[model samples]
Target: MKKRLRDLGEDALIARLLRGFPGGENLRVGPGDDCAVVDPGRGLLRLLKTDAIVEGVHFLPDTPAAKVGWKAVARVLSDFAAMGGVPEHLLVTVAVDPAKPVAWMDGLYRGIRKCLATHGGVLAGGETSRLPSGAMISVAGEGRVERKHLILRSGGKPGDLVVVTGRLGGSIRGKHLTFTPRLNEAAWLVRNLRPSAMMDLSDGLAKDLPRLAEASGCGFEFGEVPATRGCTRAQALGDGEDYELLFTVSPRRWIAAAGQWPKDFPQLSIIGRLCPPGQGASLAGGWDHFSP
Candidate 1:
């Protein structure tokens, strides 16, 4: 008998199924990074990202269709933000129930267009299809980054200060559907400081922090977590979809950036330090798709 998807789990499934996908010569970074990075033959690099949002799995059927559209594209844009890039073009695939109202689909695309426009991205066209059960969205986007500003998840070193932009947790209350991608803030970070490593917090800090540590072959020590109001510490750590930037920087850079950090930007918190391999690092809480 075939093994169930849950038996494989999200991480295992991604590793097993996508481990061998062929990457072209221009591909600088492939699977495992927030976005695939490619050298476009210029001083600038192109970042490619694809993400899916499923009905019921990611949102309620009753959720506003406009919000649904906003989330579908924003998810991928956040990946660009994680790498300190700016979104330039987008392609969306919408799979919708046949019985859904035409107005609903219109609102969805309208919201998508509005968001792409706000973020200086173009709706470069897409495909649509009918699904038997519920609506699903697939977004494939491209962004550009200056070579000097490009940040990756594997650049972390021991002694780097771990930091997070904005608050975390409680996304299920409604933030997930409408949060803005941290494009400006991430760009600012790269322009001023060389982040040792960076990633977006989609899978919660508990799950994502471990990923950073493992990728960099290191561990970390936790400090005060900047949890969203009304959220318990555990909820802050485990509840996924915060859409914030979690990054590492050298202590010297932190002191310099801290002094000149934009007061108008979202709050920044120094949450910990990366440790050398073999040291204990907290991996206490996070979401697992296969888990109940």
Candidate 2:
């Protein structure tokens, strides 16, 4: 039997697809990261990321077009935040059935502009194509981070303390549409706490934490899973779509970092700690694109 995407799962399929892709010296970080980091021959590092939202998968048919647009752009911005970068420019590709109304498109543009205004970036340009079935919106983004402050998922140490911003899970209860990307918090972290590794929690802690541990060549032991009010711990671990920041800081600095968390954002939590590989408990289940 031939192997399909469902057989390999999203991460494995991605690995198989990009197995032989070449990387240049300028490529600071490529696939398997929140965003691609590139040396643009300047003082700063360039960050590149692309993300998409589909009609049925990401949103229902009756979901607000404006929310969909915001999510498409915000998703890319979240990746930039994971890298401790700033979004600069964006290009969007929109595909929808020919019958989609001009008003809907206008609403989407409004949401896009609003997200950029709230976050940081501009809609440089984009392309539009007709779709025979449902709608899909893709956003490509460029961002910048100072060389000294760039964060990657592979930088965690075995003893680092893991932290997360904001409560997790319960996104399906409408938080997904309005969740804020932790850009400002990330900036503060790099400036002060200086986390060793960082990534946004899009695929839930269950799926994403393991990726970080594997990348950093470590394992993780859970402390307390922080779920949103009314959500169970299981939901906090496995219910994807929580666009919060999950990061690791040196154990020595974890205390000061926790003490100095800004008052504006009140949901910082110490969720876990990294351990030596093969010494931690298991975690499984999250939103998988190809899983039955």
Candidate 3:
């Protein structure tokens, strides 16, 4: 019989599953990373990403309709932020059970509208379908970055400084519900310093950083990670949903911008450096879809 994930727990299960997967040419980073990376070409790249949130899988049945809607949009926006791209438009598709009330659907749309307005994202177009199961929300976002300025997981070189835009862990408290998108910061980074490599912390850095290293053909060494208030070291390393930017820069540029970066935003920090790839990406913690 196939073993259930809960039998092995989150970390062991992910290790086993990822062990069998192979990397692809277009994929600078694959399933084990913060986010998957694909190279579209050299100049003026388009970033297209989509995420789905299901009623029971992603959120509770009683989750506020508006919050659910916001999350759907925010999740895609977060991916754009990771790439340091400017979000221009989005297409949202929703599926709801026939029994769900019309007002609930209205509330969901209202939440989506609020997020779009906040992020300066234009609602392009999408479709709706009836679901026999429960509600499902999927959002596709379109963003653009100058060819030279686009950041990828493969850009980090050995000895480059690792930096993060915000604190980590315990997002379940309330931060996950109302976290900001980091749109402005991404723009600033792309325009000004231009990180060597960049991605957002959707999955824990322990899992994601290794992916970045693999893409860049390097490894990493962490000195200290900036922890969120009330977060443990393990939590800081493994907890997901921080939605903060993780990037790399030249050591010299990081020193020059260190003073200036804080003036504009309060959450930035340098966490580690890149090294040559050795063993596969090693994380202190891991997440698994099938594991508990």
Off by over 4 Å in 2: none
lDDT of 1 by residue, 174-206 (tens): 999999999889989999977999999998999
Query: Candidate 3: which stretches are off by over 4 Å?
Result: 1-43, 262-264, 279-281
TM-score top scorer: 2
lDDT tens string, model 3, 1-292? 8976667865456677788677776554455433344566555566667788888876777878888888888888888877777777789899989899888888888888998888878999998999987899988877776666667777888889889988888887766766787878988887777899888877678777877777789888887788888899888888877888889899888777766753668477888888777833356564545554
Model 1, residue 131: C-alpha shift (Å): 0.3
Backbone clashes in model 2, listed as residue pairs: none
What range of 10 consecutive residues in model 1 has the weakest lDDT sum?
A: 283-292
Q: Quick one: how many clashes does candidate 3 have?
A: 2
How far off is residue 57 in model 3, in Å?
2.9
Please give the distance, in angstroms, between residue 91's alpha carbon in candidate 1 and its true position after superposition: 0.5
Q: Estimate candidate 2's alpha-carbon lDDT, on a 0 to 1 scale.
A: 0.91
Candidate 2 per-residue lDDT, tens place, 13-110, comes to 89888988999999989999999999988899999999999999988888888888888888899999999999999999999998988888998988
